[model samples]
Target chain A: DAGVTQSPTHLIKTRGQHVTLRCSPISGHKSVSWYQQVLGQGPQFIFQYYEKEERGRGNFPDRFSARQFPNYSSELNVNALLLGDSALYLCASSLAGGRRNEQFFGPGTRLTVL
Target chain B: GESVGLHLPTLSVQEGDNSIINCAYSNSASDYFIWYKQESGKGPQFIIDIRSNMDKRQGQRVTVLLNKTVKHLSLQIAATQPGDSAVYFCAETWSNDYKLSFGAGTTVTVRA
Candidate 1:
């Protein structure tokens, strides 16, 4: 089976602009989560959606939001982007939303804010 | 306020030698731990995982040792090879929590 997949592997946006990144989870997976990885740093959790409901959220600002579809795909949106927002946006999927499941990650979308 | 952290920023070893990476976590409540390997321009790949109930778990060529008492975690690579060069991160999570707190990561370089 294919692993988690992401779209628009690379994106360039300007300050104050908005950008959307997409992710398609592995087949039979139910939970999807988003994380932001800055260069030279580990990934920071952003949002987690299970059964299309928000299950967990990280310390990110209100400018960041995400939603999951019925098919378990997800979209991460950043509004009024800042230079600090430039990083790799990663998506991970698990069989469920709890600690019992192991998450599989995608290649991630590289967002460059100019 | 709980977090995970690594002891060293980088480690260099000969291709035939063994590699050991260490991590410390502040959360005593954390029961699940995982180790990930990330290469340049790629997402983290799962290496191995161990739960608080267990002290050690071994994979193909990797071993994860968890010390719940010391709140420490370590990953050991046997007969390290060039393909093992990458950044390794340790993550912790509790039973009820869906989020994982990751450490800064340790970069390993294998010299042939």
Candidate 2:
């Protein structure tokens, strides 16, 4: 089966602009999560949705938000982007939304804010 | 302010040799730990995971050892190959949490 997939592999935005990234979870998966990875750093959790409900959120600013669809796909939106927002936005999926479940990740969408 | 962290920033291992990467976590409540491998321009791939109840777990040619007493974790790869070259990260989360906290990764380079 195909793994988690993300869209718009690359995106460029200006400061104060808004951007949206998309992700589709693996078939039969019910949980989707978003993470941001700065260059040379590990990924930082942003948001997690399970069964189409908000289950968890990270320490990111209010400018970052996410929602999951009935089909288990997800969209991550960033508003008023800043240069610090430039990084790879990753999406992961798992059979469940628990910490014990292993998460499979997507190739990620590279976002650059000028 | 406690978070997961790695002991070494990089490691170079000869082909066919064993490789070891270490990580330290400060959250005493963390019960689940996972190791991930990430290549250039790619997302992290889960390698293996071990619960606080277990001290060691093995999968394929990899072994994860956890020492709760010191809050230390290690990943060992047997007969390392070039394909194993990548940045390895250790993440932790407690039973009640839904997000995984990751550490600064250790870059592993396999020398031929």
lDDT of 2 by residue, B1-112 (tens): 1112458889988899888899998799999999999998888999999999999999999999999999999998998999999999999999788999999999988889
> After superposing candidate 1, which stretches have Cα over 4 Å from the reference?
B1-6
DockQ, 0 to 1 scale, candidate 2 = 0.80
Candidate 1: TM-score of chain A is 0.98
Best by TM-score: 2
TM-score of chain A of each: 0.98, 0.98
lDDT tens digits, residue span A25-110, model 1: 99999999999999988899999999999999999999999999999999999999999999999999999987568899999999
What does the lDDT come to for candidate 1?
0.91
- Kindly give the stretch of ten consecutive residues in candidate 2 chain A with the minimal lDDT sum: A94-103
Q: Give the number of the best model, judged by lDDT.
A: 2
DockQ of each: 0.72, 0.80
Alpha carbon lDDT of each predicted model: 0.91, 0.93
Q: Output the worst ten-in-a-row residue range by lDDT, candidate 1 chain A.
A: A96-105
Residue A9: error of model 2 in Å?
Answer: 0.5
What are the models' TM-scores?
Answer: 0.95, 0.96
